[model samples]
Target: MQIKPLIGALGAELLDIDISAPLPPDTLAAVRRALFDYQVIVFRDQKLTLDQHKQFARQFGPLHVHPYILAKPLDGHPEVLRVVKEKDDRRVFGEKWHSDVTFLERPVLGSVLYAIETPSKGGDTLFANMYMAYETLSDGMKAMLEPLTAIHETPVPEVDPATGRPLEPMRLVNKRGEHPVLFTHPETGRKLLYLNTTYVTHFKGMTPEESRPLIDYLCEHATQAAFTCRVRWAPGTVTFWDNRSTQHLPINDYHGERREMHRVTIET
Candidate 1:
């Protein structure tokens, strides 16, 4: 497969590889290397069945079932999560920047998302390179963050009064964990800014009010355009992202259009 860098920040596009079929050992190695180096990889114009998508993701690691409290599993495939936005639906998922499932003690390693349907305009995903976010910090800032731990937690979802179901399909059980503010990547051994606006509520030993300024500053600094790449989706496009080294946001600009995607998460 030919790998082309998508932007200077953190994404690459893989061309000429059919993910539906098993990859040769060398090709798989190359793909893994590209994923580690770039943090996010995209494959466009490829069609894959739900099974094929799960199979491809499993090649990297065992599939992870999202805690049902967070998202319901897709029918017949407990490991796949369906992300849908109806034409009239007002809510959106992943609209805020985050590393998925960080509240778990062992967060997911990565995620594979295949676009089955896409809006006519304005449903792009943005990824920020956390490695860059950490590396560019002043030495004093790095020193302060290196030894600090932060709390991550998902908010409880609101139930709809009419249906008695969650207004959204997902809910967080309020799962919480403490993770290093500057996390060292398991494979690359590179340090990354690991907190997110969505999941990280505060620093371990501080009040949310006290943590506000620093958290807000880091969130804003880490996602500056210079450290990010945007991916515009098309039907049949598949994107794989390393959750450990990057944070993503799904732009919800297409309010009245339909978009659907199937996702599989890889266990770390």
Candidate 2:
């Protein structure tokens, strides 16, 4: 497989490999190395069945079953999660920046997403390199963050603006956990900015009000343009990202357009 960088900081695209078929052991090893090196890798123009997708992801580790998503898993494949937005849907999932499933005590190690349907325009996913975000911080700031742990919780349903009634309840799983503010990569031995706007609510010993300023500052700083890359989606495209070392935001610009994707999360 030929690997090419997608952006200066973090992403790379892999070419000439058909993931629908089994990969050779050496090639799989190379792919794992590239994932750790780049944090996010994309494979374009590939087709995969739901089973094939789950098989490929399981090669990395056992797949994770998302506890809170209301959508049912694909038949016979409990590990696969369907992410779909209909043409008239105005609300979008994953529009905010986050590392997947951070509310779990053992958060997902990584995620593999395969695009089966996409809008004609405006459905790109942005990934930020948290390793770079942490590395670039001032020593004083790094020192302060190293010992801190932050709380992460799954979101509750919002009240509908039209009727002033709560939206249908989403299944609440294990909703909360505390993780280190600076997460160290288990394989790369590098520190990453681990707090996110979506799930992280406060530092361990501080109230939400007291943690607001610093939390806001860190969220803004970690997602700066220089540390990020945007992947424009198309059918037959698959992207894998190390959730431990990066944060992602899916753009919600394509209103009145349909988009569908299948995802598998690997255990860390």
lDDT of 2 by residue, 1-268 (tens): 9999998989999999989977899999999999999999999999898889988998999999888645457877888888887787776677688999898888677999999999999989999999989989999999998899999998765653223356676344548988999988898998888999899989999999999899999999999999999998999999999999999998888988899999999997
Root-mean-square deviation (CA) per prediction: 2.5, 2.1
Instruction: Look at candidate 1 and give me any clashing residue pairs.
Output: none
Which ranges of candidate 2 are over 4 A from the true structure?
A: 159-165, 169-174
Model 2 C-alpha RMSD to native = 2.1
Query: Worst ten-residue run, lDDT, model 2?
Result: 157-166
lDDT of 1 by residue, 150-199 (tens): 89997665863222455665444567888999998999998899998888
- What are the lDDT scores of the predictions, listed in order? 0.89, 0.89
Where's the lowest-lDDT run of ten residues in candidate 1? 160-169
Pairs in clash, predicted candidate 2: none
